[model samples]
Each structure stands twice: as structure tokens, then as C-alpha cells.
Target: MSTTTIDRYRFETGIYRPPSEGGSASLLLRYTRNCPWNHCTFCSMYKTEKFQLRPVADIKSDIDAMAAVVDDLKAISMDIGQNGTITRDAAVSLIGKVPALNYHEGFAMLFHWLLSGARNAFLQDANSLIMKTGDLVDALHYLRSTFPSINRVTTYARSRTLVQKSPEELTAIRKAGLDRLHLGLETGDNELLKKIKKGVTAKGHIKGGKKAMVAGFQVSEYWMPGLGGREMTGVHAAHTARVLNEINPDYIRSRPFRTIPGTPLHAQVNRGEVQMLRPHEQLLELKNMIGALDVTSRVCFDHAMNNWRHPRSGLLFTHDYEGYKFPEEKQKVLELIEAGLNAGNPVSGAG
Candidate 1:
């Protein structure tokens, strides 16, 4: 299946999202076409596409199309409930001949959104907030007005763009209805930040993150455990914890490094310029970071990539890793990491 540009909608969408959004019933609304700063060495999602902001008119039209689809689906449900079964022919007749509207990935997403109660939404593709503040506010307002049931709306944001935004601008955005901002703060170490081409310094991360929080938006800061490799692991963990302490974001999510093919980081690994940490080492690094954290933010090891092996059975990470509230469960999280370390598992390098 094509990863970008579903046909049912009048607009285009690029494939990318935070891991926390997975398995949620949120609708994926395409506000921007691709990553504005598609230069991060670890990301491969938007490398093939040029960044473009969808015109506000075009975005509104897409919102209208989505609303139409929802209305049609509701009508179909009433018909199906009364008739007992929905025939393919009947569905086509009711929903029209649009392939995406009737029988494609767009329809599948629409079905899931409806089934999931349409309480949340995620803006696409990479950083939606990079658009002009007035335009973004207008688009967000349109989105909420169109879907009154949506309780939360989220988007990825770059620290560079966000730091450039004034507190007033961020407040305007928050009042416009965006509830959450997910930042890929790969590491707080300046050297590691430069190595990863994250385009923001440690100060920039803290400033932008604090601005978002002050604007009343729940912020999720992403930390990569092994991004610094073996050489800078100590500083990576310590400085990341320090920054998180300063920002005190709503969520601290762990995205343990996984080298993907066709990225600069992968090239670095191949050339022996960087060495990935073994699973055990990564867990120990996480333990150290957790131990250093002094914030009220919730720490999450929920991503599949962060779950390492125990050498005995199942994952070293527990099921409650998603919302391991900090300070309260810090010791428990440390113990879990220690358990993984003591599991006698052979060191395995991540891809």
C-alpha cells in the first residue's frame, strides 16, 4: 500500500506519527505535507517529499469531506442496523463510487475513527505547527468546530520553530484548541544534538518545551536512550534528565535508538564512526536517566522499540511502562531496568 497520499481525502497525507498515537482512534488530519526540517539524521519518513503547507481553504474542504464521510457512515449504520446486514452493493450505492470512501484505506481509517468514538485527532505529516500562527489557529478552529466530539488534538513540533514562536503566539495556538505537542528531543547533550542534526541546542529544547507547557498544552518530550552510542552515554542520560527536569513536561517518552537503513545515522554506524549500545547497556542508560530525573512528568517506555529481552521469558519492560509516573514509580522503573540487566541476556545490538 502507498504510504503517502490516500485518495479518499481531497488533500495529501504523509506517513509519520509519534508511537504514543498508535492504537488510538484519533483521526489523522493532514495540515502540512511533510517535515519542514527533514534533516534529522535518524528520520527517514519525509526524506522523499518537499515540505508544503496546505492552503487553509484546502484544509477546510478536507474537513468538510471528512464530516460528509462521518454523516454517511452514520446513516449507513442506521440502515444496516434496521436491515441486519450490509451488502457490498448496498454500501457502494449509499456511499457513492469514490473508492476511498467505500473500500480503501481511507474508508478503513474512517471506520476506525468512528468505532473509536472520534475523541482524539493527530495532525500530519511531520510538524503541523510550523505553519503561520494565524493560519494554524484558523485551521485548528475549523477542525474543532467540524468535529465537536474531538477532545484532544496533537501534532509534532520542532524545537527550532517552537522557540521562534513567542509565548503569546503559543497561547493563541493553545486557545485555538491544540491540546498536545510532541517534541523529538533525541538527546539533551549538545554534542549529541549536533551529531543527530536535531537543529536545536539543549537551551532551545528547554525553552520551547517550557513555552508549550506554559501555554497550557500537554507536552511530550522524546528521549533516545542510545543515540549517543557508547562514547557519550553518560552525558546523554544526565543532560537529558536535567533538561527534562527544567521543562517538567507532561510526558517523558523513551524512544530507544534503532538504526534504520538509508539514514545518516545508519551510515555513521556502517563507517564505524558510531557504535550502538547493546540491549543491556541501553537499559542501564535508561536506568541512570530515570534515576536522575527530578520532575513530576510521567515516564513512558511504551514503544515496542524500547522493550528489551529478559533472557528468561517475555519482555524486560513491563506492561505498565506506558504511564510509569515519575517520582512515585521511579524506584519501580529503576528496578525493572535492573531486572533486565540481571536477566543474563546476551548483549544484542539494535538495528
Candidate 2:
């Protein structure tokens, strides 16, 4: 075991990733410090921090440190294979030498990443694509070069930011190794978008999403069912379906609205400015949106928040909440929603 002066990579606190990415073996890499537009009323993920992009040198150093750890683990594996077992002293000595790689959770995550074949990496701390195009492209290239085994690279992008990027810039980013872009289209109702301070209109969602798809990036658009609340439910469902129909993104992920304490939306609920839809009402809204969708993309309800259940059977329809392919499973999904509503579940009056 030998000590090295590699710069240690420490993840910033208050990080968030997509729920669907939970089982992914992707290495989490932070390119930016936080969300650039932290004004979304329903979100509090980046409220405590201001956004800043890490310098290319800083990011590359972190990547280098990660590579060094991977190499060391490979060497240890070889030694263990030949020697039958590694001694406690040998194990402690080997790990103690790398001062920069001393993060306990990081080492554990890396171990799982390696076991999962190290085939993917996810950029973190929200809106990695908002970095300067050239810097982001360079970072992507360097990351891929350092870890050739990574088959996919993904990041979250705001619709407002995506609309600002030129087609050429997005294509270059995709070519540089970013395989997918996840955009939160939350709702396509203009009034609701303003109410939530999402800072993007329905048209913006369609334009931004279509641009990414045209640039050859697999696009996943997230929609929230109860975002528009009780009065706006029908409008929310109809308009959101219209936007997704236009973009025809590779995936439409449903994230049913759940209020977080201290958020502006919660305050509105307290003041009676907005009425949050009940669980059953949210499912009915989902059914309306699904029936209205005309696209060929897969529709997913993969998040825990979306696991709507019937009170009697305590079962979630569509077989385990994995989601269903649109146009094909639309009828079956609608029937499931109808069954849940028919169960005579009470809609809670508390927002």
C-alpha cells in the first residue's frame, strides 16, 4: 500500500436524483453545485444553496481521484484471488494510504458500482446541462475517456435551460457522451406553471423536449398529476397530455404531487389559496391524462408517490407500478383507475 496526493472528491450535501435511477449502478458525479432556478414552488431540494458550476480542473481532478480508487480496488481483487484471503493489516494499510479516498459512503457506493460493472454515471446536484456548453462537453468527453466502461450518462435539465440551447450545442453535447436528458415538465397548464413558479410555459416544455429528442438524446419528461390541485385538475390533465402528444418523448414519467412542508405550495394550502387533490382524485386525473395521450412513448408511474392503491385490496393497479406502454395499455390502465375509484374510498378534505 502506498499513499497518493490525488485530490479527494467530496459530494455536496442536499443532492437529489430521479426516483427511477434508484437501482441504477451509475456513479454519481456533481458537475454543478445546485439548482440554478430554485424557484419552483413545489420544490425545496436546492433552496439552501446558491448555484455554481465547478471549474473544469476541479471536476477533472475528482474524476481522476475516482479512477485511482477503481484501479486500487482492481489490484486488491487480483491479490485476493491469488492469496485466498487478504489480512486485516493488509486491508487497513491499503485503504489508509489513500487520504483523498477516505469517504466511507463514497467507498461503499464505489464498491457497488464496480460490482454492477461500472457501466453508467449520473451527473448530480441538479441541472448539470446548464453549464457552459463547451465546459460541459469537455467534462463529458473527459469522463468517458477516464471510464470507458460507462455505457450511459444522464443528467437533469430545466426546460427553460434546454430551450436556450441551440440544436448544434445539444447535438454536440449528446455526441460528447451524454446519453439522456431528464426534464421536469411538471405540468403543461400555463396558469399552474406560473403558480408553481416553474418559469416555463407549456410551449417551452414542448420546444425544449422536442429539441433534445431531435438532437438524438433519449428524453424523459416528468409530469405531476395533482400539481394543478382540485379546480385545475381537468385542465392540467388535458393540457399536459397535449404537450406530451406534441413532443412524443421516449418516456413520460408520472410524479403525483405530494406537498412538502415550508414550500410555497404548502403555504398556499394553509391559506386555502389552493386545494390539493385527494389520492383518488389524483388517480382520476391520471386516467384522464392517459386517455388523452396519443403518443407512442412508454408512460411510467415508477415513483413511490405514484403508487395509488385501492383501500380494500391495498393493491396498485397496472401490475406493480412499473407503468404501461401507451396506446396499447391505455384501456387496461383506464380500467384499473376506474376500479380504484369504484372501491368507495373517501377523499380527504385536508390539503
Candidate 3:
């Protein structure tokens, strides 16, 4: 039992909210705190405390409270041009009807309506996947039935949980309308896996990812560049490629490593126990990863967290490694970083 409470949440802009969902427009609901499994060495997102599941009733009340203020919300949003050409009267009219709806059911409904047709939702805390499947299924169904317009419901899941769920269990949840899962498959090298306390092995990742794909869900495996640093860059790229080949997931997402102030990696950095990769070294690591890739998955470096040369370019496994030379892409990214260094950009030495 843990006693920690957060009463308000705001949507973060410019972060990947999963496209199968409506991307960034969905409200990022924080139903828990930190992460249940927070041992990943490169992660600094949730360093505050051990994870604890929020009380369902408490979450419901927050929704109810927010719902009560829907009218004020619309007015403020509209006044600030947030609703995009929405008139004050229109915002008020919508607010007047908000009371007619149940808060829990309408949390997502109001979000979609407020966004003017954008449809997706993200459950927060680092690992909403830690919630009981039954609870999640009911919550997701309530949102779906109440709104009818929500086509995508997404959450973050650790690889360990994915492996633990049986095929039938995953299928049941998928059928219940959980469409996408964003996995933090930071590295696929077993040695690096142990080094980072990633909580699951390379084999576990491969199995879990394949299970998600087998269950007919859109799966995105997030890979972290420069995670192995200068020491294990070669093995990291090669083994990560091996795992991806085995899983053949729908999307291979790139998240370049950034050590924040309070994470375990920061301590390692200070102790000289871990070395951060140079920008060009990271680019080569990315190239080796692409070259060793055997699956035809679409890769994305779309997050602002990365310094990809063509951030939107997709690694088609065929054209990306063959028709186009990855070394050239690497060079372009390195050159861009050098220019930024000359200009004194804050993330100058990063890629």
C-alpha cells in the first residue's frame, strides 16, 4: 500500500502519443505514479518513487471534477483560440450538456469533442499496463461505448508484462478494443539488457513482441540509440537487429539516449562506469542496426528526442539499407550536429 496522490493532468505537446490513436490531441491521464519496473538504466522519466496504482474511485472523482468544469474549460480554451474558431456561445452550449453525461464515461468524450474530432486517449503513469487486465478492459470499454468515436486506445507496457500474458489473454484484451502498445525495448543485446536492468532478456522481448503482433495489435518497439555507449556499440546494434528480425514488429521507434539529472545513468556518468557515445558513433550504431535489420518493418525517428537527419524517413528494411546508403544518412546527421556545435546549440553533441 502506498499513499501518493496527483489531482491534475495536462496534455504534453510534441510527444509521440501513438498514431493509431489520435496522436497528441488525446489527454494524457495520469492514473499511477512512476513505474512499477523502473530499473531501466537510461530512463529518467519517473525517478520520484516506487510505482503505485491509483484508486479507481479517486480517478473517477478526478474525472467528475474535471467534467464539472468543462464549461469553464471550453470558454478558456476558446478565448485563447484553443478550440480553433470556436465561438463563446458554442463552447457554453457544449458545456451545458456536459452535466447530462457520466464523468468516467465522458472524460474521453469531452476530450474528443473539445479537440473537435480528434480521437485517441493515453493512460499515464509510466506503466498503465500494470493495471489489472479486467479493470483496463472495463475502463476501455466504458470509454468506447460512451464515446463511440474513439478508434484508438493506447498505453505503455513493459516487455516483461507482454511476455507473461498468454496468447488468449492478449487476444481478449485486443478484442476488447486495446489497439496499440508502446514497448520500451531499449536494447536487444542481452549483456546490455543486464547492464541496464531492463527487467527482461532479449529472448523475452522477441517473444513478447511477437505475441502482440500475433494477437493482431499494432506494436511499436522503442529502441534507444547510444544506449550501449562507446564500449558495446557493435554488439548492441547487431543483437538488437537480431531481435527485431525475430519479432518483425509493425514499427521500430528510435529514442536517442538522454541522461537527465537524477537517473541511475547520471550516477554512472559521474563514476565513469558508463561512457556516452559520440554523435557520429551513435550514427554508425544506427547504421549498423539498419544494415543488420532483416525484417520489413517501418522505422521512425519521429520523436523530438532524436537528432535524425531526415527525422521522418522510414527504414523500409529494403530501400533504407539497399537503395539508399545508411552511411550517407549517418554523415548527414553528423554534419548537422557539427553545424549545430558551431552555432552553439544546446544539444550540439547529440544525435
Candidate 2 on 1-351: residue-level lDDT in tens? Answer: 334443443433224778755453678888898889999999988788898989988888878877776666556656666342323433444566765445544655655676677888888878989899999999999999999989999889988888999999999999999998889999989998998999999999999999999999988899988888899999999999999999999888877788889999989888999888887788778889988999988888776665566666665554332467777888877887887777777342222
The TM-score leader among the candidates is: 1
Q: Between which residue pairs do clashes occur in model 3?
A: none
> lDDT at 152 for candidate 3?
73
For each candidate, what is the lDDT?
A: 0.81, 0.79, 0.65
Runs with alpha carbons beyond 4 Å of true place in candidate 2: 2-14, 82-105, 310-314, 317-322, 346-351
Q: Residue 52 lDDT in model 1?
A: 92
For each candidate in turn, the TM-score is: 0.91, 0.90, 0.73
Candidate 2 vs 3: which has more lDDT = 2
Give the total clashing residue pairs for model 1. 1
**Compared with the true structure, what per-residue lDDT tens digits does model 1 show for residues 1-351?**
232333434444446777666554578888989888888899888798899988999889888878766665556656666352333444554445454444344555655676677898899988888999999999999999999999999999988888999999999999999999999998999999988888899999999998889889999999988888899989999999999999999999888788999999999999999888888788888888999999998888677676677667677665453577878988887877777888867344453
* Candidate number of the best lDDT: 1
What tens digits encode model 3's per-residue C-alpha lDDT throughout 1-351?
A: 011111232121213244333433565555566678877777776565777787666555554454444545556667666774434454454435443322334344444545565466666666666777776666666556644656777778877888888888788788888887888888899999998899899999998999989998888888888888788999999999899889887778777786777778778877888788866566668778877776656676655555433323322112121122233454443444344334333231343
